[model samples]
Target chain A: MQIVREQDVVPFRNRVKEFATKIGMSLVNQTKLITAASELVRNMLKYANGGKILLEIISKNAQTGVRLTFIDEGPGITDIKQAMQDGFSTGKSLGLGLPGAKRLVNEFDLKSKPGEGTTVTVTHWKNGR
Target chain B: MDRIPILKMGQFLLVTIQVDLYDRLALNLENDLINMVSKTGARGVLIDISAVSIVDSFMGRILGNIASMSRIMDAETVVVGMQPAVAITLVELGLTLQGVYTALDVEKGMELLHDKIGTIEHPEDEEEEAPHDDID
Candidate 1:
């Protein structure tokens, strides 16, 4: 379990990188994971108030991959469906956080409520790893 | 036109540029990136492209340039918050960036900078002579 505090984002990144290294993710996949992880982590700070992230590596024989989970406790998203749509961001930057993170990996799932916060999970196969 | 100019934020370097769909500006962005990377001697970069809505093939090429530039500079670059709609449109237009580093927002991008740049302990760097003047 990796925890990201309100003001500390660098530790979270190093933690994620360390986590990826332990999982034996290839350089390519590691970069992808890093990119995806940062995106999710950034969203926690920007949209949500703050949150913690959990990264778990899963392997089965010839197949190896990573599972990322982000849980944020904030005001929660008002529109998850619309948020998933391309070009839909509540901030000034181009609205590609969720969707771009989704494309980096093989599997992605996100859940959020208006007042319940947001939880996101993503997985990338070793082939895609 | 003059240089697009590079803006530095302590450890984070930024270059705010506008380019046509042609490959010219995109290539220029690449060259400017090299100069900025040399000058700042920082570990990472945050490219905030919130103003750009249209991403052409030339724009797509910028990612590859960033990736290569980072490697040579012993630094890393992370593009933050590019428009997702532009992403889709670029891909649909048969454009792709094979190797690139990207983040969702500035916060996370900072995190990456820390991870990559944190190893430097500058106890002697201030006293040492820099090798290049190309950075300025």
Candidate 2:
């Protein structure tokens, strides 16, 4: 688990980029993964005081991919379905945080409780599957 | 006080960001660009971001804000030299940078600025017989 802080954003992105590159992911796919990672990491810092992220390189049936899971024990999302909608941001942002990140990755999973916390998992396959 | 330098070129202001900008540095750039536009009466502002490799929502907002603020001050802002990866990332992040002009490179951005705001007439183009007063 990696700590998520404002200062950690750039270094995190760089590390993710390096990992994606090492896995032979295309430039476009690498960029997408890094971008999604950036959004989720920032959300951790914004919602929770701070959080931790777990990065793993996974493979399934000879297909390789990168997976990132963000966990925070802050005030969790009340209505996840609504929160997943674009232009639906609790923060005074452009409201594209959740939905935008979902679209950029191959797979997305989010679980949250009103008072417990939020866990976001996203994965991007090397071949864009 | 780490700040990007803003140079005056004729009727335009040029800024090149060669480093990764955190929140404070980005905010300082926005403030400096606006003030320079006001103080110099610059008609166009060109920002070169070819060297910048990473940008987040905050940085994206700063770019948009600088464009809007320059517009309010009667100056046009053109963002130039965005990498392909950065473009895709911004689009995925839902930042289209609406109302802000963009170019592939500095030369094209300069041309675009000249189109929006006419070029500043050079004193060398004036006749020798005219007043010998120095404008610089």
Q: Which is the leading candidate under TM-score?
A: 2
- Candidate 2 residues lying further than 4 Å off, grouped into runs, are B120-136
> lDDT of candidate 2 vs native?
0.86
Highest lDDT: give the candidate number. 2
Tens digits of lDDT, candidate 2, A25-126: 998888788878877887888899778888889999899999989999989999898988878888877777788889889999999987889999999999
**TM-scores, one per candidate:** 0.49, 0.87
In candidate 2, clashing pairs total 0
lDDT of all the models against the reference? 0.67, 0.86
Q: Which pairs of residues have clashing backbones in candidate 1? A: A126-A129, B39-B135
Query: After TM-score superposition, what is the CA distance of residue B16 in candidate 1 from its true location, in Å?
Result: 16
In model 2, residue pairs whose N, Cα or C atoms come closer than 3 Å (at least 3 residues apart or on different chains), thus clashing, are none
**Share of reference contacts kept by candidate 1:** 0.00
Error of 1 at B110 (Å): 27
Maximum-DockQ candidate:
2
Candidate 2 A-chain TM-score: 0.96
Off by over 4 Å in 1: A1-7, A60-62, B1-136
